[model samples]
Structures are given as structure tokens and as C-alpha cells.
Target chain A: MDKMVYNFSAGPAMLPVEVMQQAQAEFRDFNGLGVSVMELSHRGADYMAVAAQAEQDLRDLLQVPDNYKVLFLQGGGRGQFAAVALNLMGKNAKADYIVTGQWSQSAVAEAEKVGQVRVLDGFETTGNGPRALADRWDLDPTAAYVHYCPNETVEGIEYHFVPDTGEVPLIADMSSTILSRPIDVSKFGLIYAGAQKNIGPSGLAVVIVREDLLQQACPHTPAIMDYAAMAKADSMLNTPPTYAWYLAGLVFKWLKREGGLEAMGERNKAKAELLYNYVDASDFYSNNVHPQARSWMNIPFQLKDDALNDAFLKEAKAEGLLALKGHRIVGGMRASLYNAMPIEGVQALVAFMDRFAKQHG
Target chain B: MDKMVYNFSAGPAMLPVEVMQQAQAEFRDFNGLGVSVMELSHRGADYMAVAAQAEQDLRDLLQVPDNYKVLFLQGGGRGQFAAVALNLMGKNAKADYIVTGQWSQSAVAEAEKVGQVRVLDGFETTGNGPRALADRWDLDPTAAYVHYCPNETVEGIEYHFVPDTGEVPLIADMSSTILSRPIDVSKFGLIYAGAQKNIGPSGLAVVIVREDLLQQACPHTPAIMDYAAMAKADSMLNTPPTYAWYLAGLVFKWLKREGGLEAMGERNKAKAELLYNYVDASDFYSNNVHPQARSWMNIPFQLKDDALNDAFLKEAKAEGLLALKGHRIVGGMRASLYNAMPIEGVQALVAFMDRFAKQHG
Candidate 1:
């Protein structure tokens, strides 16, 4: 009997309905403990178990190698932008950043504060359409790491293949695209993502780093931000965002029940294809990114006439489709189809778009 | 009805039952928006209203001066430890740290990473039975600032009056004692608290800094940690811990309903007096801290027989008085009576302690 709605906000995006239901069901009393999970001490057994199981579930889902240390930390992707530089560039003092879009460019700004940063263009665009990801980059072989963003939420660009960094450690900010399918944990020196998108909520960031890379953190690094220190403390170096971590655990369980990353990958591909295909077929709407570079997580499309932007959003809200307004930088519309966004939502979005186009044609 | 439980956690502690209930009731569909508050975009109108209202309510409760900028940020007290040093000691590169206990000592380590730190003994204990707070300290007037922890959670020491630092800016880590009572906000240059105790949850730290103190951040300071940058962006430089922030707003509203901090101060004083009075009267239990220095927030006591510690905790848990175990450094029992802890909880704890002492006497 509840009104049906599908949210399409880019980050701090939607999570599975089932996870939300279960969280509500036990919001006050967790595990019959007579307190909200958020109220429990992180050092206590009940909370430790919750923390450990969430890590285990994430490890199983990612099939992470034994040599990597998984840390759940506070501060979002921007925090890790500084943390990565502070943690890894201590000895070498330099790294290469492949600038893809807004997120990756922002990461460069943070890294520049810590050490030497070489910025390389991540993609080439013809006009304002058909942006092709640059497979080859002029990387510094002796750099501490090669950092890049796999999916750019603002520009709706993504890499279909991971870049090969050879001897240099490859680091990825997968904030928008992580857990969408699968990743090779051994391929990168580290992978960090803000948990707002596919994982759980904002305020928590998950970092998976090779144990060997953990030794060279800057002496001045805050113990909380020092990867080595946090790894040693098992990410309890400080009281973590406990509620967000709990919610992430619920999401991980939902992922497993829905057949893990493999099934999620298939569903996500189908959903992205549904929206992209409809956009390609329409004269009234179009997505600018190249087919190969178009993101499966965020699809940004523009209306033929920008004047109808408000009307489109208003009508969409009336029908219970939400957050379709595009980023100010790219003015039009964006429908973020993360792992939690079911195919039906995308179908509904496409149906709305068709009707909107017909009404304004 | 759910079982009654009073969680005595140090941080990531208890919140008002009404706030928790409201949060749970709206967990799935916040404000009938058909999406969890966590799922809403921080940049959106709905979440912005929530964020703004929280800050306004906090300002109203504290009577914060117009010159102070309040920031809700990620990472806990420890994160702010580094942030305070990085933000304040940029030009001067030195500060006096009055060491009170574990939390203050930890802050010194982080500050030492940034600049020269003078560690002044905060209190003197005579034979571990009575500790007296140092009324005056050998301070550096030319230093960037004077830093101290108002209430030490682990050692159960608290300052009844603020330390005078003349022209030097005074910063208080009020993580344990903030919002339990009324204080003159204008007396200190800056005040910060990890939200778990008196605010909301673990992920957020609330910082109230004088406008003049916001400048002079180290260039290398991560934007996420940079006070000026965070203030300029309204703590939205990145997606904030939206859910925790919302819950904190709910808590501020609850405080208003409960007659604000003045009423809270009276209630807390009564609660602390009841437990401390009972301990003072009992030969089987004793608290070593000087009455003048004893913490109203954290009260640590010792059993006459150390072997009965486990039994005490087990029995207390059964009676729903949870997390009474003391810190490892201070081996005894600690009961954190934060703002959310009602007088009834303290009464229950005292009655249980009396019965336990008689049984083991």
C-alpha cells in the first residue's frame, strides 16, 4: 500500500529495500541486546562480532587475497585522497594521477598537498560527445603509485578494463563503481571507496591495501589516517562509524542472498543497457559519453530542450521517480543505477522519459 | 514492551530513547519521501534543511557567538586531535598541551607530529588515593594555543573550571563532558567533541571554532581536515555522514523538549551525586580520584576484592546495567553517565552495587 519510489541520487545513493526493512525491524533492539547497535561499544564482543563478520562478508564477496589488509575507516573518499598520499608517498614522495572527471581531479588536489603529483588526462573527447578512455598514459615508472578513478560519477565515464601499471603500484578510487561486479584484489597496490554509493552510507570508507605497501606512511600521518596504524588496530584505532558499518553489513548479506557480485554484475549490465539503449534510440534525449566509456553505475543524459528540466523533474516526482536532476557541471539529468537499483526502476525511468519527451516534443 | 537497558559505553554511547524511536519509525521513509534519510542526497533540499536545522538548534542550545563556525565532520576526537594541531599551529609551530589523562596524552602525540609540544602535568595524585587538578600551569604565552581535555574518560578526572591561558587561545577537547551542562562558549577559542557521547553517534565530530582561529591551517592539511575549507563548504566538501548528522539533529530537538542543557545540568549533577555519595558511604567500594577532580561523566570505582570484578559485571549486565568494565590502564569499573543516562539508571546501578558489596563483603 506504500507509494512506490525509486531514488537516483549519484552517491549517498539507494540501497536494497530488504536491507532497509531489516534495519528498521531491529533499529532499537539489536540481537536482543536491548540497545541500538550504534550504542554498543566497538570494543565489546557483540559489536566486534558485527565488525568482523562485515569484514569477512566483504572479503568473501571481493575474494580478496590473504596478503591484503581490509580497513573500514572514517572520512569519505576525499579523506582517502589525502590518506593514500600520506600513507604511500612517504618514501617515494611522488605519484601519477590519471584525471578522468570531477572526482579524480579532486583526488589530485588532495595528493598535491602531500607530495609530487603528475596529472595525466584520462580520456579524450570529440566535441561534447563520444569520450574515449585513454588506455595508455605517460606514467612515472618510479612513482609511488599510479592512481585513477574507475568510474567518474559526474561525467558518466568509466573504464572497462583496468590499467596496467607494471612495477608501479596501481591504486583505484572506486567510490562510484566498487562492488558493481568483481575486481582482482591482487592487481592493485590499494583500492579505496567511500561507502555512500554501493556499500552502505556516507562517513565510512573501505580501504583494501597490500600489506607490503603499509610500511611507508608519513611520520606525521594522524594515527587515525595512518594505514599501518589502522591496520594494526583492525580499524578500531578510533570508534568507527558503527551504525554505517552495521548497515554495510546488512547490505553485504543482501548481496550474498541476491547471488553475490556475479549476479549483481549481470543485473547492473542489463539495467544500464536498458536506459542507454532507450537514450540512443530517442531523438529527444541523448547520453554524451562513448558507448565503451559510459558508466554502468551513473548514466547522465540531456534533454533536447533544457527548458523542460524543471517540468521533467516535477512530473517525475509526481510519479515517484526521484533525484534525476543532473550535476550542475553537466546540466540535464542523471539516473544512478547502482547495484541496489533494480531493473524495474530503470524500466520505470525509461517509461517516464518516453512520456515526458512525447508531451514536450 | 522492550526490555529496559542502560548502556554505559564511554563513546558510541547511548542516545535519547525518543530520538532513537523517531529514527526507527522513519528509517524506511524519512518525512514520507519513500527513502531512508541516508539515501537522500546531501545537496538536496530535504537533507540541507535537516543539516541546517541541526546546526541552528545546537547554536541555540549553546548560545554560540556569531563569530564561531560550527562544523560536523568525520573521524572522531582523534581525528580532531591532528586537525587542531594542523589547523592552529601552522604559523607558530608550537603549543602547550596540559596533559590530563589518556585522551589528552593521545592528543599530544598527534600534535608532536605537527610541531613542538610542551607537556605540562595536568594533575597531581598523592599516593593514588587523591588526585588534585593543577590550578596553574607553566604555559607558553607565545605558543599558537593551549590544549587540554576537560574530562578524561579513562582516568575519570574532570576540570570543574576552565583553565585561563591569557591571550593564548584555549582549546578544549570536551568529547566526554560537552552538552552535559551549560558552559560559556565564548570562554574558549575552540571546542570539539566526538558525537558518540552527548551528540549522536560515532562517525561525527562537532567542532565550534572562533572565526579568527579558522585561519593559518597548514597548506598540507587535507581539505577534509582543513577547518577553513570545511567551513567554507558547510561541511559538505564531501558527502557528510548524513544519517548520523540527521540523528544528531533529532537529539538536539530532544534536548530542547527535555528543557535544554540547564535542565540536563541539574539532572546530571543529581545522578553523579547519588552514585558518588553511595560509594563514599560504602567500605566495600571506593573511588580514588579527589572529589574536586572526580568526573561527573565517567565515574570509576574499585571493589574491595578484585576477584569479584567479573561477577559484578555479569550480574550488572543481567540487570541491564551494561558496559561497566573499566579501561585496561585503570583496572576497576567505569560507569559513564552521559546526558542520555537518566537518574533512574544511576539509581539502579547504585542499588546493584550495594547489593553486590553486601553479598561479597
Candidate 2:
């Protein structure tokens, strides 16, 4: 096996080395079946077994309630922005959105095309930086749902507390933060996470929707986005991204072996602290987001001298710390420590940062 | 390397052994990037290079006209059924559909949910198996488009001739037949194929659409399915199935090295002939599809005594022939001789059929 690199891509981030090795071993033949898992018929017994286990394993890892149907769907996070509105925006024409950063803003845009959208308490740039979630907002009891992105990949901010949304169902686009830590699933009516981030691969989203929330999709909703239809078909309404789902299963099993979300949260917290503490102590480096709002999964920091950004990334790559460059929209360095990224990787990144700061300063 | 077994699954079917081997080798590190292609950023130069080459190679293989845009999309063929309607159904509210088998019927059903659909000379189920294409049909000159599935996967039928719908744009669901042969891009307004078959994996579809036909998507069309938007973004409007796209690029390169589509069509034709000749000559076996309409990719055959179906499948599996059992909806046996299936595999199947017939006949 090749020497592993510490990959910090925001999405399509690192998967556990064990998961990758297992996938490599099974790429040619899966479970004594002569065909690759990708070659098996989606309706065939073998593929269905893999699919069922993936959903079951995810349920076990998240401790997902029995009342919520877990759907392995295609079309990514952007697709779900429209899908969320189409499926849940019942007779009520308006949906409330809390815009903290780029992703939540995008969610509002897609929802606007499908139905009326109300951006409630949009993000205000504070002295430190733009906070991910507003301090407080007027609740709209009649709105279809309250939508927010728990973690913004670009903004590098996360909501540490669950918002108090009275009777309206809470819908979260947890694309970047899902599975990085444990959350109360019962509090939110629907939670969607793109698989590319912390889950498994690209091109699929795992939507966990409360059973009662399945009613009242828009008349023009695409069948692929119809929550009720998808649940009824058990996410086999169409050919799924079988390889991604299978790989996610491997990651789920790996998570269970590593002691599930509870253990993951502790390790992730330690990883975040190691980097944040190092940055906070150094006058040469600074993170823009407020400490309370900083995301544990994605930690974006900037060098005091902006001109050194390119040189910093190049040197980091040479050190086998890959993809530390922040999103193009937000210039600087962002290290995404997903569930698969080990604490050792974060320690290496902190060491690199310390060396780079001393050399440049 | 494990000894290869012949896989006869219809879709999510066989990929070239070379492709699988290369993917396995790169599962850990791609191009010495120290991260799997699945872990690379979609917008990164390395991944974009791979994505661009995939589109270029596919264009070269098919000789796709410059006027047509090749889009790498998510949500499979079932999604395209509605996307085709949502995007192309302009001022004219109706589209003509030729229902040949289970797939085409599905196309009509999904299209009906989005827009007006008129079944054009649908199959009457004559004494032979459901004929894929209607022998004669009235062309709806004023309709938005003429939709058909050139290959019906479940019924194991294919249309050897492109339909003559003068002036009106023609849309084909070539999910199972794409890349198996050369095609005239000028004849069709849009051509879509789910990647699970000849392309790469499930949950991704490649849509080749003429530049002029991109206008007038329905107001409710999901942004992911909007051709003009996807075309502008080069299919990176959202996160694509990056690993699948990379694997598909590898497949395209392999196809090019094997002398492109002309060579592939010849190999596929010869493989089909070998199996069809054996089935036609044997008294114990029978194929229902007409000679002209038989698919070069998938061949469905029945045993003289239906009771022997299970036994035949078991013996075939033990003999290293895997997934030969026919679709449950259309029972007996289906031997899908896709592009990856070697001529030797077909010969082995023929030999196995002979032995099974002798033992049971």
C-alpha cells in the first residue's frame, strides 16, 4: 500500500484507510461473488443485501430512530436543496431559511424556484466575522419548515446549538458536518448529507426523513426527488450509485469498530483543538470565525501575510499534507478533518503550520 | 488477479477487466497524488483534467458532432425520463413516445407525470416477444420530441434502425446500447445513457444534447437536470460522481486503444452471432426476439421445459457463468454479452448449453 497522505479536502475528503483497502480487496470480487459490486444487478439478491446492510449500518452508527426512513439518493447536495422544498413545502407556499453562509444561501435560491422562501435573520458580519447561525429569530409557526446548513464548508462555521423552531419542522443541510459528531436526530424532521464529505463518496445523498413528513410533495416534483415515492421504493426507485453506497457501508462498519459517533466526536474535538490552539498561540496565523461558531470538521485559518498563502500550500503539499488550500470563494487555508481523518494527521498539520509560521515570520 | 467469471447482469453490468484492475491499483493513490480520485476536489486541476479527457475521449469515440454537448449528469435513466420532458417540452406541450418494452413504457409513464405523452404505435404483443419498435407510426410533427428506448433491457430487444421523424427532434434512451456501436449524432436531438451499463457505474447519466434544443426547460425543472445550466458548468454545476467519471475516462481510453466504436461494434456483433447461432440450432433452447430486432448486447432465451430454468441457472453458475438468470418479469435466462464480455465467454456459455441440453433433453 502507498504511504497515506493527510487529505483535507472540504468534500470528497479522506475516507478511512481501512475502507479504501477493503474496497481495493473487493474491487474484483465481492463476498465470493465473481462480479464486482458495481457489476451486480441493483435488484439482485447480492446487491440488495449490500444496500440493506449499508442503511442498517448507518442507522446503527447514528442511532437513527425507527420512524425515520433512510434513503440513499443520487443528485448530491444541490439537488436536495430543490428536493427539500419540493417534498416538504406542502399547501403552505413559504419556507423559512436561516442564511449563515454560501450553502444556506444556495438552499434558499433553489427553494425560491420551487416555492416562496423567507430568509429569516440572515447572517450579520460581526466584528470578528460572520456567525453561522443568528443569535435569535422570530419563529414562523405556519411556514413549511425551517431550513439551515449546520456547517458551511466555505464559511468554516457551524451551529453549535439546535435552533428553537417552535412547531415548524427543522430541515438541515448537514452536507459538511454529518457523521463528524453525534446529534439528536429526533429534533430535526429531515436531515440530508451529501456522501462526499464525511460519509463516503460523491454523487449521493443520504436523506433521513421522519415518516410523518413524507406527505405533500409539490405537484411538479421530479420523481427522483419525491420523498414518499423514494421511501416506498426503499431508495431503489432508480439505479443507485451502488459503489458509493457499498463504500459508505464499509466506513459505517469501520465507525462502529472505532466505537461509533461518540468516540468519533472525542477524537475530532481533540484534532480541532490541536490545530486551533496552535493557531491561537501564534501571532503569525489567525482564524476568522468566532471560536464558538468555528466548525470542528472544517477549520479555516489565514496567514497574517496573505502573500504567503500559495507558498504555504505548496510547502504543505511537499510535507504530504494535501488539499489544505481553502475553498476558492474563501481564500486562505482550510483543513477539513472529517470522520476518516485521524488525529495524527491533524498533529502533522499543526507541526507544519508551526514550522511554516516560524520560517515566514 | 482472481480468475475472471463471465457476468451476464443487464445493467450495472460488466466493466472491462483492464478498467477494474486500473481502478483497484488507484484506489489508494491516483497519479501519485497521495489521495484516491474519490478524495480529489472536483474543481481541482487534476480532477478537471480527468473529467475533460473523459468528455473528449467519448466525443472522439462516438464522433459526436460539435453542436452537441456531452453532459455528465446524476440520477440515472429514470430521472432522465422526466428531465427529457422538463427540458425539451417547449411551447408544444406534448411528446410522442414509442413504447417497446418495460424501459420505454417506463419512459412514457415518467414523462406523462411531467407533460403530455402520446404513445406512438405501442407494441400489441404479437405471437413473438414484445417487439421493441413499432413497425409503422404516425409522426407527430408538432410535438416537442419523439422519445424511444433504442434498447429494452428487460425484454432483451433493440432497434437496429433509427426512426424517421423528420424535422422533430428525436430522443433516445440508449442506456444499455451506448458505446457498443457507432451512432449518428446528427439524427437525434438528445441521447442519454445511464452509466451503469456500458459507461461506468450507476447513479450517473451521460446526456448528449444538440445545442439548439436546450431552451425552454419547465419552470419546475431541477437545476441539476437543466441542460443549459449543466452545459455551462461542464457538469460541475454540482459535485459529479468523480470516481465514476474518472473510471469512465479510463474505459474510454481503453476503447480508443482497442480501435474505438467501429471495432467495438464488430466485436459485439460477432459475440452476439456466436450465442444466437447456438441457441437457434439447439432444440432445447429458443429465443423469441426477431432476428432483425435481437440485441447485440443482451440475448434472452428460454428452455423448452420451463421446469429446468432453476436447474440450468444453478449449473451455469457452478460452471463459472454468473448472473445468467433472466429478469424476474421476463423469466428463463438472459446472457448479456456487453462490450467487456470476451468471445470466449460466449463460447463457454454455448458449450455449457449443449451439455445441459444433452443431460436433460
Report chain B TM per candidate. Answer: 0.97, 0.96
Cα lDDT computed for each candidate against the true fold: 0.92, 0.88
> Tens-digit lDDT track for model 2 on B13-101?
88999999899888888888878999999988899999999999999999999999999999999889989999998976799998888
Our tally of clashes for model 1 stands at 0
Model 1 chain B lowest lDDT segment of ten: B127-136
TM-score of 2: 0.97
> Which tens-of-lDDT digit does each residue in A1-361 have in candidate 2?
2564898998788899999989988898898887789999988899999999999999988889999999999999999999999999999678899988899998888899878888875454454333333545776789999999988889788877788787899999999878888988999999999999888999889999999999888877888899999999999888889999999999999999999889999999899888889989999999877777788988888999889999999999888998888887888889998888998899889888889888999
Q: Which stretches of candidate 1 lie over 4 Å from their true place?
A: A127-136, B127-135
Which stretches of model 2 miss by more than 4 angstroms? A1-4, A125-135, B1-3, B122-135
lDDT of 2 at A190: 98
Residue-level lDDT tens digits of model 1 in A1-361: 2778999999799999999999999998999999999999999999999999999999999999999999999999999999999999957699999988999999999999889999988865454332333445677889999999999999899888888889999999999878999888899999999999999999999999999999998888988899999999999988999999999999999999999999999999999999999999999999878667889999999999999999999999999999999999999999999998989999999999999999998
> Each candidate's iRMS in angstroms?
1.0, 1.4
- Report the C-alpha displacement of residue B192, candidate 1, in angstroms: 0.4
**How would you class the docking of model 2?**
medium
